[model samples]
Target: MVIAIGFEGSANKIGIGIIRDGEVLANVRKTYITPPGSGFLPKETAEHHRNQVLGLIREALDVSKIYPNEIDVVCYTKGPGMAPPLLAVAIVARTIAQLWNKPILGVNHCIGHIEMGRLITGAQNPTVLYVSGGNTQVIAYSNKRYRIFGETIDIAIGNCLDRFARVIKISNDPSPGYNIEQLAKKGKKYYTLPYAVKGMDVSFSGILSEIGRKALPQKATKKRKLDQEDVNELPSHEDLCYSLQETIFAMLVEITERAMAHCGSNEVLIVGGVGCNERLQEMMGIMCEERGAKLFATDERFCIDNGIMIAHAGYEMFRTGTRMKWNDATITQRFRTDEVEINWEVGKV
Candidate 1:
């Protein structure tokens, strides 16, 4: 019966959410979108969070119909995100916790996605594919940690898409990745790009570099063909988007299947911002079907960075005797998934 309010601003998005036990009472979010051909920077993103967080918190409280005294705890993302934005949101969370006289818990950004995915989809002990702007990982529960079986060796999948959007001046209104996904839907041709996967690890820098060349004007790109194939001029941006999605998603599916096989798990759960793409879900669903397994997932509401996830993950830790003092609550820019101990029940979660 514990009530928790979570704050999240790990990247361009800022969100406030309130939950009672496992039921979501309020979930609200706002994004700090930059102009076309540009991505959000850490300082500006932090400023946006500082400006919007209090208002969003008020909105969450209003929607939840809960008094400040009723809140059992305040939760915020601790690390593995941009520094400035994470600090801004963490400060707000700590401030609110102090004012409310409640316990403050610092939750891992990646585990927030995994715990929220489990809560929303009701898929216990499934292999997790966490794809976000800042992270790309294939993980599963083993020995009480969300063990990383495979991850990006260089740039993350979402970061790769975001940078590519800047090349073609794609809209960043909803998101660069979302716009790219929409354009990919109308593509009718396939252009080969670099594929980099080694054992269980994958890399996106090569793929982004390869496709970026094709997306540019002929004069701007070097006169070179990848894989000894003809460097054909791209027909349209739509085709470029389509090919990019197919190539990267295939790499993801391949590694995810390998992890699934290694773990002997029949379920695959997709979590994070990139997980919202319908094409990725469709591809992963196909892979699961071929393996005679189930695929658990959610739409943008749960998949995208949101506060409910932070709160949910925080509660999971707080109830298990985890708490952070205000002075000791620190935000990090590079927290790994395997670093956190999963104290909550695994299959039962």
Candidate 2:
């Protein structure tokens, strides 16, 4: 039985998890919440991770009832994330591995999400819909790599939603997306927004720009303050939120279905931070039902970024004889999913 300790701080959340075999023994995370109308800065987020990561790691070890010497390997997310935050976590991970004298593995953030989703859902070779603040893509495993079948041309869907939330100054306590989803539930009208899909890819910048024009006053763009009367002059916030969710989620579902048909897969696995949105899951479920396919998703626990995923995927890599030398444990800011060689999946029918 392999025991792995994983660290993840690729973005605003800092997580420490311990896993035994395929089951998670402990998974803990702490997020840095910025005030309303502001987004998390990389420097500040990295500092937050540095400050809280050690405590989180200790807490995870205590919760799992495992000794540091019992850990077989250490894993950390290496890429496709904010540089500062990734570096902060990578430094900690390398230090721990050196101190414990354990093998260290660097994992791709995107592939970690995919592997964890498959492990949790028991979905065998399903088309993957990975949506997060930094990424949005429809992927399928082919030729020993997760190939991108569809992706966003501009900003990711989560970024679009978060920026829109900033326009209205929503709280970032739990999450901007979650707050938008709750507000969307109160919407009675559906305002039309721009929908852009070319072939299998989708675009959200245009949709965001169009929504801003309708939702904000002409002068509100320069200064993000709006009086109650000014707010009434524009479309209802709930309506805008509702319409945004419906429009973008429809695009996501359409692309995912296209990938399913192309790959001849009857199962769809959703992962990443935005995958926790109930509306997205509901839309994907409806689409899968129409096509006689299955939909697999996890709750917020695994849906959002966590260290367990890094541990799980890293363990798979370790089992396949994949290891990163101490000097080669550098992080990549633009690591593509297909760049990693997935040796573990070889010879599987």
Candidate 3:
């Protein structure tokens, strides 16, 4: 009965998870609400993390009914996120691990997401479509590593949507994506958006800019104010929403199909924040049905950001003797999934 405590303070969310063996006992999270226009600020996020980590840790431990001294290991997300936030959690976890005479492992964020999908879905050899505010990638497991077959060349899908919402002055109260989806539901995709796909890589800034220009005209002043007024109505919003979802999801389906064709594997798994989108799921389901492939998705628990996945990934790493050197352990904002070297047996597939 190994008690493992996992911490993920990457980007705007702070996650904490407790795992025993392969079971997730408790998962807790805290989100940092960023102001509109300004994105992630490392300094601000770090300050917020410093205050939230202790509380979230205590909550997680209580939920798991595990005492600090009983913990066998403390695992924390090492990188591919904001440096300041990473450092804040790392310092906390490292100190806790040392105090308890327990081993500490530094885990990658992307690998955590990948491993969570594995734990929840029991996917052995599945192609992964990871789309989030920070990342957009199509991955597959091969040779004991999650290989990136295709990804966004510039901005992530979520980022483009968020920026587009901001440009249109949409409400950012609940979530940018949700607001955009709501607006899109009522509006018509009156304008034709660009579909740029260079090989497997995608670019969305062009489409976003184009939409913004039409949604909010510049030189028109009050010339075509009716267009803006019409956009404020529901039908126009729905159409735009439908169009945006259709275009982006279509691109994803196309690339995913290409990856499946290339890898010769029919099983597909979708992960990350955007994976929760109903439209994306429908598109993938329809495409997979046509291609005679299967698409697997994590439920809300494992789909969005959570700490359980971190604990699960950390537990696997610990089991496989994947530990980081004290001095060599460092956080990165650009860690790729394929860079991780795991020792899982290929025959398990």
- What are the clash counts of all predictions, listed in order? 0, 0, 19
The runs of at least 3 residues in candidate 2 whose Cα sits more than 4 Å from the true structure, single-residue gaps closed, are 219-229, 346-349
The digit string of per-residue lDDT tens for model 2 on 1-349 reads 8999889999999998899989899999999999999999999999999999989988999999999999999999999899999999999999999999998999999999999999999999899999999999999988888999999999999899999999889999899999999999999899988889999999999999999888777866454777788867888889999999999999999999999999888999999999999989999999999999999999999999999999999999988789787888989999998899888772233
Instruction: Sort all candidates by TM-score, best to worst.
Output: 2, 1, 3
- The regions of model 3 sitting more than 4 angstroms off are 35-38, 187-190, 220-235, 346-349
Task: Assess each prediction's global lDDT (C-alpha) against the native.
Answer: 0.92, 0.92, 0.80
Selected candidate, larger TM-score, 1 vs 2: 2
The stretch of ten residues in a row with the least summed lDDT in candidate 3 is 228-237
Error of 2 at 32 (Å): 0.5
Q: What pairs collide in candidate 1?
A: none
Native-structure RMSD, model 2: 1.7
Error of 2 at 241 (Å): 0.5
Encode model 1's per-residue lDDT on 1-349: one tens digit a residue. 8888899989999999899889999999999999999999999999999999989998999999999999999999998899999999999988898888998988899999999999999998999999999899999998888999999999999999999999989899899999999999999999998888999999999898888778765554365534322335445899999999999999999999999999999999999999999999999999999999999999999999999999899888988888776677889788899999988898933
RMSD of each: 3.6, 1.7, 2.7
Ranking by lDDT: 2, 1, 3
lDDT of candidate 3 over 167-188, digit per residue (tens): 6666655567767766656665
TM-score of 3: 0.91
TM-score of each: 0.95, 0.97, 0.91
